[model samples]
Target: MLKKLILIALFSCSAHALDSNIIEIMQYLQRDSDLIQRGFFLNKFDIVQEGIEKHKVDFNTLQKFNIDMFLDEKHINYSPIISSFLRNIKENRIALEKFLKDNDKIRAYEAFQQLDYNCMKCHALVRGW
Candidate 1:
């Protein structure tokens, strides 16, 4: 009877650990999605802004988070759809960063267009839309 109780306790602890890991994974996914949306909005503002004053809000928000934080492995999933989504986000970010550093609005806008398409594609693929 004692051995059975010990086994049951061990099983319960293992199940809890598994549940925690799953929750952690979901949180990471949510964080990545939020960051992507924020970046998208910032890039949009950068394109639309006619002057520094028009961009101040987006610029401040962008500056609040280290972009690198969004590029971590937590954003990726083993599934093909999720993997592609993450890869596209990373590529788009690189392109946008380069364009921004060069002060090239045209290229930045192009990159933003591609990023928007990627977002739609990922959503349709994942959500069956």
Candidate 2:
């Protein structure tokens, strides 16, 4: 009985950690995304008067980034769909980061478009549309 209760407590703690990680990712996705949209799409200077902030996501906490945070050396032999989804997310993030670094409006908007698509797909799979 004690062992079972301890295991349950450990699992609950892990779940809380996972939820916090997901929330942090969501915050980054929503925050910097708005910055990009305002700066690129609406051409708003007041919002990003100084300059755009770079993304601050730590990919390690993401469950999909299993085996390697760099997402290069280790590979998952999962189904093509899952593997492709992870790749798409990683690629989109890289593109978005590059566009942010360069401060290119057109490219930044395009990268945000692709990022939104991936986000929707991932969200639908994880929760719902």
* Top candidate, metric lDDT: 2
Q: Tell me how far the alpha carbon of residue 43 in candidate 1 is from the true structure, in angstroms, after superposition.
A: 10
Q: lDDT of each prediction vs. the true structure?
A: 0.55, 0.58
* lDDT tens per residue, model 1, 37-107: 45546865443333222223333343343333333365334255655655675577568667866888678
State candidate 1's TM-score: 0.42
**Model 2 per-residue lDDT tens digits across residues 71-129:** 22223232355456656866776786677668775776676688668767755654424
In model 2, the worst 10-residue window by lDDT is 67-76
In candidate 1, stretches whose alpha carbon ends up further than 4 angstroms from where it belongs are: 1-78
TM-score leader: 2
Provide TM-scores for the models: 0.42, 0.61
